[model samples]
Target: MLTSPVDDEPPLTGKMQPTNVVVLGASGSIGEASLDVLSHLPPKRWQAWGVSAHRQLGELSQRLFATGLRPRFIVASDPDSASMAQGMPWPKGSELLFGGDALVDLATHPQCDTLIAAIVGRAGLESTLAAVQAGKRVGLANKEALVVGGCLVCEARQVSGAELIPVDSEHSAIFQCIQGSSSPPRSLILTASGGPFRTSTGEQMRQASVADALAHPTWQMGRKISIDSATMMNKALEIIEARWLFDVPPSKIQVMIHPQSVIHSMVEFVDGSVLAQLSPPDMRLPVQYAITYPERLECPVSRLDTLSRYDWEMLPADPERFPALTLGFEVAAAGGTAGAVLNAANEAAVQLFLDGEIRFTEIVPACRSALENHHFEQHPTLQRLLEVDRWARAEVQRWHSGTRA
Candidate 1:
């Protein structure tokens, strides 16, 4: 969770000039951690230029109070939930913007040097693409953006010379290890904590309750992602993210259930040397890394105790027990619209499972059905990808609601 560990304390030598930051999902777990990192830095070094919340104003307000930083701009995507943010305590001169397009406006603002695209799901796509197109350094934690529109995001970055620093712990580890390497990696190994049901048998998993699935073992995460972790579907989406982020074939990516959650990820080179990034499972480390990318700073998170006895272990994931692992590789191999359908279907299915509309075991099967039922395109346009995304969500709903797919 703490991205990669830094060996030395970063020099705090100068009166840091402010670097404008816009956090898209200011209320979410990742966004809040990012804010925490910003607060630790000298105010001159970095500042919260803008922040957005979908709902959760009370939590956002607390975060603002803790940081002692009032962002210049704020957006609330939920219209009715917040008719206006004007009534809240502010440091004065802060502009409160509304509606969906406000995300794009804030992301692509001339003053915004860094964009934290932490908004979850495909809903974050439009603003994320806007940031990429504007050539801003984007700290991407929204798995759906890459999973649903990997081509669009990568292609836009290539054309615009924008830097996409992955914020997810696993991808961040891979990013740090592969830096300045001469040769390409042989494969990428993403570590999974195995969630709460990591050791459960197939029969036992089928009977898991929502409360059980939400009880993640190692990390505290959002509800939807928590369930995805239990089902290992989050890793599946990350498989797609790795493909786009590292330019690796699906075969070059592998998943290993590291129950300890100490080793974030590992990269194997052609020479058989394995490069691994290990740290305490703290989300702030990665968020801090992304915020201060290309510059390693001292982290507030704890470092690994080299003197302590270690019982590190990694086991091959049981495909029979956690079938969602197969779906990711399958989607990655298929490419194009397959990723879109799979990501959207999984999102919808996870929500259904959360609502108790569908059972925990039904999540992956619903996603599989959507992918199988949808039309597959090898090279899909953005519009085509979005079309498939909507269809997949609808298909999952129909499948669960007893409508024809």
Candidate 2:
């Protein structure tokens, strides 16, 4: 659940103003984790002005009740969830915001200076874009915005000079390691957990159960992301995100299978030296880091003091073992609307796989098929990208249903 940590705290006097934050997808695991992080901030350092939840209205309301914060507004981005949350007890003087437009409105709200864009999938693109256009400091929790709308996002940042701090661990790791550096690194290395299927064979993965796929070795995540991790597609999308976030060519970004999941990511300089960011496998560290950028705040969660006890394990990403990782590199290399098509197809395929409508192994192949079949657009306008997004989703659905040519 999301939080409004500003309620109990008194104002800061000198050089310590709070960040006025708006959280999108306020009911997910990330939202829940962010609440914990926000609660620990020195009262004067953070203020959650608004929050938007797409589903789980009951849970959202319960969490909101605990905070005793009557926010400026709360958004239910889903119609049914909106109706449900409206009936739930809210703090006095609280106003309700509904639908995508409401989310956009809040993103552009003058009071909201920081945005935690966590609304998942392509659904998160518009509000994220809105935050960027409004020049809000964006702590990006949504990968789809960068994956499907990287070009649009890049253009907006160039025009508005909006700051995008990645909430994803991998990107944040790279961001931290590269700090104080004037030049770009020679290459980037993103680490993966190898997921639950890291050691499973292709036949075993093909026959893997939905429950099996969701059993991630590390990282408690929502269903879609957990499944994506199981298939290594999350890494793929992050590869694309890193390409845009860091302004690097696809060849410079590499993925390594680190089953321990200790080292978030690494950076290799032009020289022989390499730098890496180490933290306990905690999402709040990065989330807090993004919120309190340029300054690391005292977090509720402490770090592992014994650094030399555990051995670090790292291995090359086996493309044959996890084809989803390949898709990200492919999309990164291709750029343009190819990312939109690939991401849309993967979104559809993952949903279908979750619903038991498609086999576990079919998800990546389905995305590849959609990418290959789409009319390639080297340079696409936002409208063209949206058109391709819709086309790819439809094609994935038809193909999943055995209705496509």
Candidate 3:
């Protein structure tokens, strides 16, 4: 059963003092935006405890120095023994630590009141789980963590009093929509821009190149993610993520195509009322929301002006056009290790397609094939999830080699 840390809401009231924060994946898109949000906050209350980046040590150091708040720790996930964190003075006895493992250490640091799990992909899983286990309030942008090990992470949150606020714009919208509603939502509708090729035929999709796939219509993201968006696989993975995040079954979750990308998500109650969260497509808005929940900020990234002249339309997602969504709902319904295997296979297949080794259409097929053939572990442990992830990656490799050559 899904659980919420209701017994540990910390009273939800005060002068709203800023908490000491550690930002994992400090060089990524969400991380950079988080730094911007942090910069806007009252400095005396808020402190940047640490920043961790995959390999952008120089850039990370520059950002830290520019903030003028020396961090207690700085980490580089790359292992050249590079120490950009060194020489940045800390208050009194504060220390600077460098190295790959420092990411995990700082994530669960004793002094950090909040940790932003913005690291993308499976690389972020361990650090995110560590922060949750340590009971730090985690703003989770890393959906793959929940995708791979939602049950385990949910269990950890129950035990550790960690607050896992959804940072993805769609999930964040759903989170906001469900707040204070008297009735349980009958359905949750997640909106999608359908990426760049929402209407492309199967034949056209088979011919789609990486450049074509990465041309996302509504949002700017990294290459890997943009490609995932094009295939609609990102939304597929999100279905599974949302299932765990909201504790709702797959049957209650719905995906709708909203090409304008204005309405992020909506919740329909049994009383026939729908609560929708609408906003301009900006990651900072959701990032700010996650940081300052239960309070509205005076400044926002962007707002939707309903009175302003705008053309909008919502359409039922055509399963014939996008098979990934169907595959997502199916895998999510399957539960157990299927989520892990599906995500791992999609990750691998996306990489192969991006490398020009597979067609865009093949991404979903590869994932479906992996999901169908894999042996599902009924009750999965963390080790079991990892094992399934590993096996799926290998399965994708075998499929790629056989088909590509």
Candidate 4:
């Protein structure tokens, strides 16, 4: 059984009482965006209480210094980066901690009102789970935490009464649309930008270089995510994430290629009503929404200009071109160690592609091979999931080596 925060504590009433936020993965794109959101939010309503950097301690320190944001605790999750942080000027009065466990410590700390779990990949799973277990309001930007262990995280959230709010633009849009009606949503429609290769031929994609794949059309994102987008694996992963986040069946969730990306997502009701959330491709909007739920504040993100005529297009996603969608739906429906395997395999395969160790087209096949070969478990513990994660990663490596040999 997990413990929760004090029930008797008074709720936030005014701007005078600030919400203390712990942003894990404080050096990543999402982290930087989150920090920007926090900075723009009224100072009395939010504070950067704690932050962590996996290996970008120097950059994190520089960002903090530049922003003049003084967090109470600064964590360097990679122990090797401790020396790099030694010379960097971190904010004054910030106690610097080192190693992965420090992330968990900051997550479950009593003062942390909201935890922004933005660490990329499986490295964030444990701390995100800890925050949920401790009943912290979690702004989950790390989809892998749920993709890898949705059952465990959901179970922890249920037990601790933790609020698992999504920071992903698509999911956040769906979340916003669902809040409008008292009726249950009939289905969720996830929109995709179709990446840089939406119009590229299969042969063209097969010959795509790292530069080609990372050239996203609308959204600016990190390399791993950029590749995932180009391959449509990011949408696939979002499919898995939406399944768990909305507690909706995979069949009820649909993906459409919206090249313009003005419509983030939509939700259909039983009455044949569809509500869509539309905005420019800005991450700060969703990040800010996750931080302040049930309340809308003035945001720094650019507003969608209604005066300009727009050409918005939504097309059916072709799973034949992007096999990763098939894998995502399969993993979501399987609901066990399958998700762990798929996430780990994709992460490994993406890294391989980035390293030029694998072809652009090999990423999905590699994930599929691992998912198909792994042992299926209907119910798995956290340790089992982690073990399966490692096994799947190794399986991808073996697949690569065997393919080259």
Q: Write down the TM-score of every candidate.
A: 0.94, 0.94, 0.90, 0.96
Candidate lDDT scores, in order, read 0.87, 0.87, 0.81, 0.90
- Alpha carbon lDDT at 76, candidate 4: 85
Query: Candidate 1: misplaced stretches above 4 Å?
Result: 1-17, 403-405
Model 4 over residues 133-252: C-alpha lDDT tens digits?
999999999999999999999999999999999999999999999985888799999999999999999899999999999899998887878898999989988999999998999999
lDDT of 2: 0.87
Which tens-of-lDDT digit does each residue in 24-120 have in candidate 2?
A: 8878888877766766676566877788888887877777777554456789999877668878887776778777788888887766789999888
Top candidate (lDDT): 4
Ranking by TM-score: 4, 2, 1, 3
lDDT of 1 at 32: 85
Local accuracy of candidate 3 as per-residue lDDT tens digits, 1-405: 101232243643466655778888877878887887787766666667777877766676666666565566667677653554454433343454556577777877666788888888877888888889989888888898888888888889999989999988899999999898766789999999999898887788889888889888989887777887898888888898899888899999999999998899999999888889988898888887777777777544766786799887888888778888998888778778988898899889988887888888899889988988898886798888888999999999998787767
Runs in model 3 lying further than 4 Å from the true structure: 1-17, 65-69, 81-96
lDDT of 1 by residue, 217-314 (tens): 88989888899999999999999999999899999999999988889999999999999999989999988888898898887888999899999999
Q: Extract clashing residue pairs from model 4.
A: none
Q: Which predicted model would earn the best TM-score?
A: 4
